[model samples]
Target: MEKCSGTTKATSKKRNASSTEASLPDCKKLKSKDGGKTSSNKVQNKEKTKMEKVSSKKKHKFLGSTEVSQSSKHASKKKIQDGWLEVTKNDKGQLLFKDFPQFQPNMSPKEVLQAGSFGGTYFRPIYSSVTKQHCEDEWKELPEDWLKGLNVPTQVASSTYRDRVNTYKVKCGGSLEMWESSGWIVTQDPYGWFQWYCRFYQGRRTKDDERQIGRWAKCAGVKGRWRNNLITKVVRSGCGFDNPTVSPVVRQTLQHWGYRLTKEDYKEGAKRVKPK
Candidate 1:
């Protein structure tokens, strides 16, 4: 009976050891599964973070391009505004010089006639008369001797004559005989002369007058070369004569004068004498 009891106790201890071994294997398998799941989650989280960073960088790049485009547009607008302002300022400032004493009105028909004479060589009278009419009030009258000193002919009868006497005759209702007797040639048609007259007096006269004269000058010689030469002479002389505002006759006269005349010499004349 004692042997049997000892054997039974040994069998029970073996069974208990077997049960512990089985439970230890189950615990180790559960731990391994949990570790694997955690590692997979960590990898997913890392990938998600990298994708988010890439998306954020792309957004920043796109936004930077938009900002740069807007800035460039704003700068361009600013430059245009500045240029406009400069033009406005220059125009406004020119008004102050309107009252300058050197300003003169367009010359009269009688002055135009005298300017064509052999003894009356200075063509300013003829040019001023035909081109500028509005500024008459501002001009200081000149003396008679001013022309004599310049060595200009009192009567110009050749093709090179600066005065468009024949033109004036046709437009002003003078007889053709009068033009012939005056030694004037009919180079420009009446319409051409009228256009020239209108342009020669543009800014100094009314816009209506300017248009009228421009049409006439166009009739006489609408070519660009003639127009450009007229403009060049006016600019170089600094004669205060706006080339765009005068008749062809006046333009021709100014061109001739520019070839021989100097601004300094004219200024001296202005100082010494007043326009009659």
Candidate 2:
């Protein structure tokens, strides 16, 4: 089973907008020729120009780097942005294909993390500096905000997979060993679907995207057996959507699969069931 995952000191010396005009000889000359009135006007003009420049720089910082469109040229380059690194080419220098159409997942990697999928034990054996560094690099590539309320793996004991961290507060999936023996583990995404989803969301399109996407589609898509059957069973019971007792196991299962059972889904299923 796939377990889900500053200051600038320069202003001190500078007083006010007048300081800008004070440095300009033209303004001094204008003041000498036109008296205090023209000096005021020039100062206003200089201040406006200064404000504009500052505003432009702020916008540039806010926008950051432009995302290069995925193309043949960019295939060999590695683009690092936010907290993650993107390598389009392998060590062999051959382009890994990522031509799948954009698939907008219902939940983002951050949302899943905050929601507490994977029982906090997903990232295990992180005690060593080498392993810790590997985990740090992965988490760093994501938005810094997504990790605010999370449990950072500190020790092998506490960080060991705890079902309490999951949204359902229960273990819902098989162990990594089971997944590997079942042949569900892909070498590219050793953690399974959730890992693939996270990497895919990060824009690291590899030769494995299509296969991974296909696997997700089969498991969680609308016609998915796991989801549709559970919805049918829950709705027929006439239990309210908010009812925690309604298929908690299946709900946890879906969450592990990177999908959540919304009230709308429950209501729709209720509509289909004949009242018992």
Best by TM-score: 2
lDDT by residue (150-191, candidate 2, tens digit) is: 656731113566777777777778876677777776554555
lDDT of 1 by residue, 1-276 (tens): 899999999999999987887767443434445545455456668999999897666544542331212234344233222222111112212111132222222332233434433122222222122222211111112224322333333232221333334322211223333533454322221212322232222212222333333333342222223444444445555555443343444444433221112343334333433223
Candidate 2 error regions (>4 Å): 1-104, 126-140, 154-159, 267-276
TM-score of 1: 0.18
TM-score of each: 0.18, 0.57
Best by lDDT: 2
